[model samples]
Target chain A: MNGVKSESVREPLILGNPSLGDVSDKIAGIIESPPTKKFWALVTITSIIALQGLCSVAYTVWVGPGVWGVNNPVGWGWAITNFVWWIGIGHAGTLISAILFLFRQKWRTAINRSAEAMTIFAVMCAGLFPLLHTGRQWIAAYWLLPYPNQMQMWTNFRSPLEWDVFAVSTYFTVSLVFWYTGLVPDFATMRNRIKNVLGRNLFSFFSLGWTGSTRNWAHYEMAYLILAGLSTPLVLSVHSIVSFDFAVSVIPGWHTTIFPPYFVAGAIFSGFAMVMTLLIIARWVLNLHDFITLKHLDNMNKIMLATGMMVGYAYAMEFFIAAYSENPYEQYVFLNRAFGDYAWAYWSMVSCNVLVPQIFWFKKLRRSIPAMFVASLLINVGMWFERFVIIATSLHNDFIPGSWDYYSPSWVEVSIYVGTMGIFLTLFLLFAKFVPMLAISEVKGVMPGAQPKHDHH
Target chain B: MEEQTLTQPVKSESAETEASAHMEQPDARATSDPLAVMGDFVDPNEVTDAARAIHAAGYTDFDIYTPYPVHGLEKAMGMKKTILPFFSLGGALFGLGNAIFLQWWTGTLHYPLNIGGKPFFSPWFGMPVMFELTVLLCALTTAVVMFGLLCKLPQWHNPFQKDAGFRRAVDDTFVVVIEAKDQRFTVDSATNLLEKLGASNVRLVNV
Candidate 1:
């Protein structure tokens, strides 16, 4: 807002021998992000499909989870897999918005609006999973609180499921708060720019009467700093709790100390990959190349590379630990996954999530738009495989041999999966069409050599 | 939103001359030198230009204050970069101190309790609060420092109050004031000097 002051009345603020390259029409275009439409078709179709998936999920809740293919040895199946996949996708937004903000990474402003939107919507998708998986659709609220019914039934607080309610809700709330707070100032900018009467009012309502007063700017900056600080630890904890839902179980393969960090790293890795895939398309379609520069894409590639390596490490470490644990049952769980009925899924996971991301080590690949796109798509596929291997391998070889059975998803299961894809794309399409998917004002704040020569603070 | 061409008057201006002259005539008529006799007072703009010349000639005690942050006024007057970090440090230390003290009070001194064989006093668990406190303190301190600056807080009146409407610092006008308190400053000379510095307006404050 201080920047908005007319430079006319006085001479320019910094009468430096500065170049006009950064504040030119090209730079202005980057700041004022345009809309994209390429994904709109995909988003619409996905939304319809996701809505059907929602119906299937809701139907399963109404009738029971029995309508589909999950069974004794493979009780978790694609429902839980999709749950983990969606939750992992949700992780990147928080990391980008929170961690990068703390580091003063200005490039984060380019991707954070879309990323946070991704986080909120992905959480919506993630929350639906556990709700549907429970089967008792009407009784979902009971799980939220530990209360005695008329029959004096007390829900077990000791269960990791209870911890999940707290963790996921907290993560969602904090993320929502963080996302909304960042939007307020931008909303003020929009409010000031709107033309039509109703549109102006709507923008103003959300902007909360921000006047760009120094006092407000002071507090707004403080709150943002605090939220970023709060979100850093939060990003680590939320997925760790999700991982605990498996690791805390008595299941032989699932009971491992490494799940916490492994899950967190994989979440971040997959999240970044998803962010990359969307951002690349977003930049191209929206014509936001200036805001979302090669620099941003390159930085994301580095994270993907780092996280991909970490995810691969977790996989290897899990294999090594299972082999050395001296427990036949745990070792068999690992072996069964490699040579089991789902071995294709397991190998796909390893190759896509692990090997392909290594391409980013080449700076050319990271900087090249097409190369980054291909690598990002591969990372997502690899992440999905990672979840499939985790869920399928663990559920396949239970303690009883007679109860063992190979799990295959029915057409209904496949359709629901497609529906989720539909839902994700549908929402994403809307984001591209309407939202100012890039942070314009923040980008202006980060121009090199723009601040006073000395520390104004 | 509205495309208004906000072209304010260039250096040589209108009622602006009257506003500056009003602030200086009290100190200006002491000399009827040809330069001073221009109008029973050197027009405030002319003296401000002279002060800027003195500034370019390198004198340190002179300072500029505008109703708003001026673009080139600081360099035009040759002011030193301020020591806001001193206050920022004070704030950071304040936060660090608070976080440490809070943890000490609650964990070590307050009633210590054990839950699940965990120490009630693990300041480590309270690390989030401590971290938040440090940032909170530093941020608040910067505000205090800024207050001690631009507004010179606690006391309501400001030294920059050479003109009643100069309160436009919060909105528009940029002003430069040479203080009566500075050793290098004499009321008569400071006013005359600023008149020549191309100051759109200049004045001496009672400070």
Candidate 2:
């Protein structure tokens, strides 16, 4: 907690000035220099592969969503799962920036900028899924409205789908605003420092004419505190509502009250994992190691462990509740999930989310950056499988014996999944290369008082 | 540093000595400038009297900016939170409405066929979408309100012109700037008040 608190003090000083100082100039030089052999090769290969994936998405959108196979009982398939996964992956940023801020966690300063960026990018990836899933893809604007139709029918307000429309879109908008507001001062700092024409113009536009006056800062801090408070609940509620989508349903596994908390916990768990992954890569790529240290990774791992434990608790309680209930249908569904067609996926989820987190019990493992990185990646894979098992297993077989069907992804589904992965990594790489991967200003703000010392009682 | 309160009476000091001495009368604590009072004194021994007076009177606008954060300042100001949640709720509700609307149209209204013998309305299945949207909305609102309200988003710029020195908000410093609202807010009075309250070198910042 003290570590986190110190981060706030560090952020303002670091992030306060965006102008590429002597250090920033050095960073710019490295990224711009022509790579000799291995580095250039990796960059070229990655760009081509990502470009192809980009083309694949373009092709899918242009040619129709059918390029990815989703039909009938599995109308959602992996696309929705990916959407949930990506969106869930962003949970920690708002949680960190807002909840931790309110709690006075200063350690958040080092990670907030990148986490916020991750939130934006993850949401972007999440947004793509629905639009791509929409198939027609072009008339996405229609999804944004509530109209009075000639048939005299209005959209059902009770459905979770409608709630999702509002939740995801609103999340995207707010994250952007929050992220940009934080960036403005840094951008202004950058603008003020630039010696070149292009740099000045770009920075000036983005900085929004900031001068860092104390009054403006005071109000800005107030606004930030309020926003942080607002985002905290949004983090909890949004995931809970998502859980409701499954929980509120009559499907044997889906219809449970526990969905909201379970899903929200899982979202945060996965989101933190994603943040960890990106931050590690970013720190290495952008040379932000001092700002994002082992301490930061360890903290994130601790969160992952905690959330993972919460998820495991939920999982355990879920089975207990299911067995305790008199209903055979629900009991049978639980039995099927463990020993039935998708048993592998269910266990995979356990290993990833439940068992793997136990490793963090050792401080040495948590502190080992590479090990933490691996754990984060495994958790993400595990969480994805968790969603897949949740969606596919329950939906594939439930209620009646005769209605049972097996599900598997086709080549198109595989490619689309890969493509989304491509997009996620590509955006992340670009961000690592371009942006100040840490919240420099906010970290500087909470430093031990810079003012003249007075004798204290 | 551990803070100790000064409670000793100056009756032993001669009236002439007492006149030269700085002490925030427990009763007139509100009238003194806490910062300047500290500037006049160099000894840590004199601080207790200053702290007690600052504490007793409850100056709302003046904060204690120490080398580190003082643990219980918010309680001192009797601070109440500003309206961040209301705006967040507004954003969340908007998201919920959107989630319910979009899903209902596509699954139930746009192509209403009983697939899997499922009812036209599956509010449960809508949870994933709704959850995402709700979180999205709340986050969105938080960001917007944070800037609009907390960050003072569109105020354009800060009054502090750039000097390399002011950039230390991040690395090291806790600052308590006394606003004009302090009961003893006049430049001279505030300075005097700070000294009486045991503050050292209370500098007035105009910009």
Tens-digit lDDT track of model 1 for A149-175: 664433333456765765676677667
The local distance difference test score of each candidate is 0.64, 0.64
Question: Which whole-number lDDT from 0 to 100 does residue B23 have in model 2?
Answer: 23
The alpha-carbon deviation from the true structure for residue A10 of candidate 2, after best TM-score superposition, in angstroms, is: 15
Error of 2 at A307 (Å): 1.2
Report the CAPRI category for model 2.
incorrect
Model 1 lDDT, residue A216, Cα: 35
In TM-score terms, candidate 1 sits at 0.68
- Backbone clashes in candidate 2 total 106
